[model samples]
Target chain A: MNSHHRWLLDQLPQWERDGLLTPEAVRTLRERHAVDDSQPGVAQIVMGALGALLIGTGLIAVIGFNWDDFSRPVRLLFAFLPLLVAQLFSFRTLQRGDASPAWVRETAALLQALTGGACIALVSQIYNLGGEWPDFLFWWMLLSLPLVWVLRSSSVAIFYLVCIAIWSVDRIERGAPWHGSPMIYPLLLLGLLPFWPGWPPKRKLSVSVRWAMTLSAIVGLCSAAIFASERGSNFFGYNEHSFFWLWTLTGAALALFPLNQAAIMEPTRRKPQVVLGCLWLLGYGIAMTFRDTTRYIMEGSSFAMHLPWCWGLLALLVVFAVVALIQKRWAVLAISSLALLPLAASPLVKAEGGYYNSTLSWFATLQLAGIGITLIVLEFAGKKGAPRLGAALLSGLLIARMADSHFSLLAKGIAFIAVGVAFLAFNILMSRLRRSKQLPAS
Target chain B: MKSLPILVFALAALAQWAAPLSQIWTHEQVLAKGTLVRLKCRAPDPYDPLRGRFLAVWPEQTDAPVPDGAKIDRGSQVFFTLTPGADGLSTITSISTTPPGTGIWLRARAGYVYDKKVNIEWPFERFYINEKLAPEADKWFAQNIRGDQGIVAEVRVLNGRAVLADLSLDGKSFREILKERVK
Candidate 1:
């Protein structure tokens, strides 16, 4: 008899006695619930480990071997070697179905990531690429993108997004011509939308994978775009052509709202997608109007005082606040503040450069303050759930920015130590909170 | 599943083709003394510091007259042919505004032409000039009082009048420089 069937039978003695299951039925149940006796042999485990070791060793050897070679063809072959091997292994595994699917997939993913890194390194080696490291990075990302769907590997997707972020920043920093194109980073995130919908709630692996992909995508895209845009041209002084391209790309990404609905299998996931979709749409609308409204307000036009774009941005914020209130998602609420935060200080500083009274400095200060407050609040309100480390890291970022502005290396060092201390304190407090919660409640 | 191998093959082919496009050449092949290499100029990257990323090329051969001032129409196109000068450096000789085929072309001050050549400098040797310094030499040639359009070439003379070297915008041989950096 199957062990599970036997246990069930033992627990239901009364039912059995009352003829709920005859001898024949019990036999049928045992047959139906029988566990497969096949077990993975020690040899298989050793082989799997050996395969992983070989893959890693091969990667290092290839990189080390070709470090000095200037031949593009040779570099290209080395870059694709791991991927080719991985594909072969995957094909064999799929054909035989002998290996654990999970392990095979994981190993394939690792190979994909290695291949991606090698591709970037090889391209960089080939290009003698100086200023535009990001452009080559974008190509690396595009090449690796197929692995995300083909291998169903979230780790590969996240790595790809990271590369894209680096590329975007590089492009913006170097002022390469990336004006009218769809921001590739955001499009890459769309791949993760599939996980947020079905089956993930029941599967911890899928949920964690989805979360990593989504978080990386959102943070990386926003940071890259902001860094690039701010560094490339003055925030407000960008030409209309540039602004139009930015808005168009953002709008197109937002227009992918229908796909979000396709993935909605549960109410918990569905609600957030709906809200995020609306916010994205509204955000783009506001971004479109931001320039014209700013111009109008600067010109002292009374009619432009209540520009529709400003209202749209404000309305989006209110919606975000309301959703956060309803869903009890404090993280979302905190992030929503970023939208209004830029506008709050714009009035205090002039458009052109000013030493102390500049809008940028004030904005930076407020950003520090906001992050600091959010950290404290998160720490105090939900001691165990507090995002203390994140807050501390953000505070550190702000301090660094301030130090950089003034060219104060000492200040930067001090700020880093302070942030580290804050992170430690938060972590310690959270541990204590968890221990106390675990104690018997009186 | 059936098409997978084909797709892989196509990708492999494309990668092979695209890989060379990113490289910059570094060898002195075809760029020896007195080569009438065409220079192609690129506008300054908006993000770079003023004149920092701007590439100015004076074709070793040109058919148009040089402008008195550095300013040229924002979007004017002019052609020049490279000439090997006595200084061993290749200098641009501006051709008349008459188009190569038609004589009715508009006469405008010729702008700089930027060209890519494999730069090779021997180890422990300082024969190769810095790219920044190269522009200064080109500028001096542009402003020389001897002619309204052309300037003296010294490098071409020094190297012995090499033939006209071909210019490639598609990054070819760039990998060689990258390999050198890796070393």
Candidate 2:
């Protein structure tokens, strides 16, 4: 049996003796879990995927040989044949409905998406139509996106999201991505959202899908800032087009989304959106304290992109904020109006600088220190997890200090590295400790 | 009701196939009737996962003599006409805002421009070849360039679309080079 099943099986007898479970329940559990030893493990699944990848790679390598002796029509035939077969497979799988295993459906959908792309690419190769790669990608994605909906395939949905991210960021390094395409990118992303979190009784998006969508949203958000430093400064003037605008807009959007409640559900009380957003906001807040970054950071809701896509979500910060004014839930009203805070701060903030020894830096240090102490006090008053969160905020705050302080660049680098090492090491240790019953249950 | 989705999936699959099919139809039309032109080029081999192995080729002519009546930037589409130069290989002679009324021409995205000269990026930058011969082709092209024989691309152009018909080194295909190496 897998270690997880063995461990669970071991727990059942103890729990029964303690009256946490009945003897009959324990017997049922043992029977269900004992058979798990014969089931495929994660390692086997990973190996299967790797094996498939290798075989696919080999096939592609052979196909890359050009089949020079074959006539043009015959080469095109090779391109279309696999795709046609994959379509027939999809039809069969669809006809089976839910009777077939999920992997079968997922595989059928993924194979269709991939083979369709390969077919397009092979056609390009055979025809010797050498153009921009994005043109090929655009058409491939255009053709494949529908399969995500028609097949109800999360795998294709994720694949489609990735394609959007790639397509949106093309030529962004030059700060001039192809116009119109990137602008409508968020709308394209939104097209998939209404279908997610499932339908009927389930009513929830899968965690991986949610995380994928979140990551893609972040890429879109970051493009605003980086793109602003180049294109926005020229057209919109700098401050009006910065990350400050992005955050305020995003924060307000998230706040408006669940409208008064957290993006989370009952019982756990875990605010994933708020906590993560807070971490990012803290980092942004610290960067703003730097002298060379631009004094205008505090001037307004700075995270706004040139396009004012502030209508977008910030990782989810108001989840942490206690402030509620005006209409009771509006972290907005006058809240969203923060879009105007950017006037001419762009004039002062150049591309680089720090707040070391600056008044703003000292003030932020005092504010975070005070909040950390207050949270510790709350923890002492019997709140669980408060002290941990408070301590993390303080340590992160200290790291921010080390970043902006008068330390040499190497010293700062070493300090950051050690902190990262500690961060990962502690998590690993905590997980083991919790499993061994040495650490307090979270 | 369930059959409706299967029908939709069938339609989606047909739509997917249509894109590559159209590409084939267009290119086949060009190959059948388009003007064939040879251009001297320096090529380096690279692998595109989708398109497989191909040469990223830099051709002899990169700029139009003088750009007339058009604002050109790195991404703007610019049409340029090709002509035979002293070496009897095609060289880009001129750029026009609109497609030229007469001679052999192809469309290219404008690259960096300087000194009133419009630089161009060739649409036919990649010349697909057999995978085993790709790295060999890269090395052989460099050698042949120094040895005074050149790698030339045979391109077919019709109505602003250019297809890389073939690549030959000193009038021989890379297949011949592979045969020599296997021996």
Candidate 3:
């Protein structure tokens, strides 16, 4: 039996003992994994990627050794030689066709990607092209593009995303006028969007695992859009509130809209966009709850806030909100409360860069708390652990505020004890109710 | 149809080889047929993540008065036409926003004007060399470069592109010094 099947079988008895699975359920699970035994699992692909990673790191180290003692011709020969070997490996995969194992595809693609980069770096050294790092990464990303598409290599696709995201940030950091991050990053992202692995949206995948994958992708994408240029032209773009609003809107868009709009047939499907969008929205919401963080939004800046700033992104958010409203996604409707979040802070600050006394952050905190409660009521229906996540969001805000609050030491200590006691009481109540439901009809 | 994957792979492989080969070719062409100019320079050792170890070579003089009525912003690419100075090393004859139609000129990035002086960021500022030899090269450079035994960067300028073909100190090529240091 395959490892996944063996592990599933091993867990069946424990699941039965815990009443998490009936005999019928255990039998079905066994039969399901039995059929899936032929398929290569994540283990194989991870091992292949790990092998590629070691070899790639070693390749770069060897190239970084700078074999400059050799004549230019000899060094040039060395440059293409490894690349040729990597290409031959890829050719072996192509000969086997698409039915070739995942490991073969991942190793070949990743190996070729690294070798191509090493070759470029080697040639740059040979010619003494002491130019920018961003340019080198850009070229390397470009050269690896074919590998991702031709091999349908998911590992390389992710690798490409990370490199390009980094390239975008690095390119933006260069501070050239008419810099490309605002326009070009999205274009490059469009190039990789077609290759985004669709497994996360599949029905069979566990929810938490799918959420993890979605969040990983969102992290990759957000790293690229660092908003360095937001300090320039347009309204709040120059204001300190820019990144706050920008990320809030980004999260709302991802949370409300189908991330992969093309594959979004089931309106209720929990995709990366929605999973991470809520997280992004809430993540920033938590940051805004900090009195010091929110105080800087309208404080210290002498310039008066203007109307209709960040219009493009604002328009996109509005369209997504409308789409959600039409679809009756009430959980997303809770996000409308965030529109008032920054305003809640507007009156809380003392003038001129003071970092304290945003008393009204509670209003903003309340908005997020409302959203968290709504998520518990709506999205977590019969779902395990997610309700705790929603509760944690609200409870987390309460703790953060208490840490900054002016409550008496005695009061704070008593509140902590009360929360701990309440948690224990709540868990006992829940377990009792669950046990009652499982009791026989006496 | 059966050979399609191979055909595509061949194209990608050819492009990968072509990118580096083309870079090497263009640099070689500049060295071969371009006008040879020596520039007074000094080197400080630094390493690049990808390009490995090299000396960060700064030419002794890289500024000129902005041409009348020329506004150069920081990060703008400015081209400078070269003329041999009193030390027999290339110095800036004039700065222009556009490439020179003829004669030996090289492009460098501009820094903000300080007292009407335009600071140029030279493209060939990195002279990549063997990693182990860089420390000794920096040492030799520090000891010998400031005085009459200045480090002279041998450069070749073709059109507006320039390449640092070699470096020498007091009539001896840098390679010879590195060789002797190794021995």
- In model 2, the runs with Cα more than 4 Å from the true position are A1-58, A132-135, A167-170, A175-184, A194-202, A234-263, A266-275, A287-359, A366-387, A395-442, B1-4, B147-149, B170-183
- Per-prediction TM-score to the true structure, in the order listed: 0.42, 0.73, 0.81
Candidate 3 stretches with Cα past 4 Å from truth are: A1-40, A172-174, A180-183, A196-241, A257-280, A286-294, A299-309, A323-340, A343-362, A379-386, A401-405, A427-442, B1-10, B113-116
Give me the TM-scores for chain A across all models, comma-separated.
0.44, 0.65, 0.73
Q: Best by TM-score, which number?
A: 3
Off by over 4 Å in 1: A1-87, A90-100, A112-133, A180-184, A191-215, A224-442, B1-84, B87-183
The CAPRI classification for model 3 reads as medium
> TM-score for model 2?
0.73
What's the DockQ for every one of the candidates? 0.06, 0.46, 0.55
Indicate the worst ten consecutive residues by lDDT in candidate 2 chain A: A330-339
Name the candidate, 2 or 3, with the larger lDDT value. 3
Taking the tens digit of each residue's C-alpha lDDT, what string does model 3 give over B33-143?
889899888788878887777887888886778888888887888999898877677788889999888768888889767777798888887888787787787778778
Poorest stretch of ten by lDDT in candidate 3 chain B: B1-10
Residue A371 deviation, candidate 3, in Å?
2.2
Each candidate's fnat: 0.01, 0.71, 0.59
Candidates arranged by TM-score, highest first: 3, 2, 1
Candidate 1, after superposition: displacement of residue A332 in Å?
A: 4.8
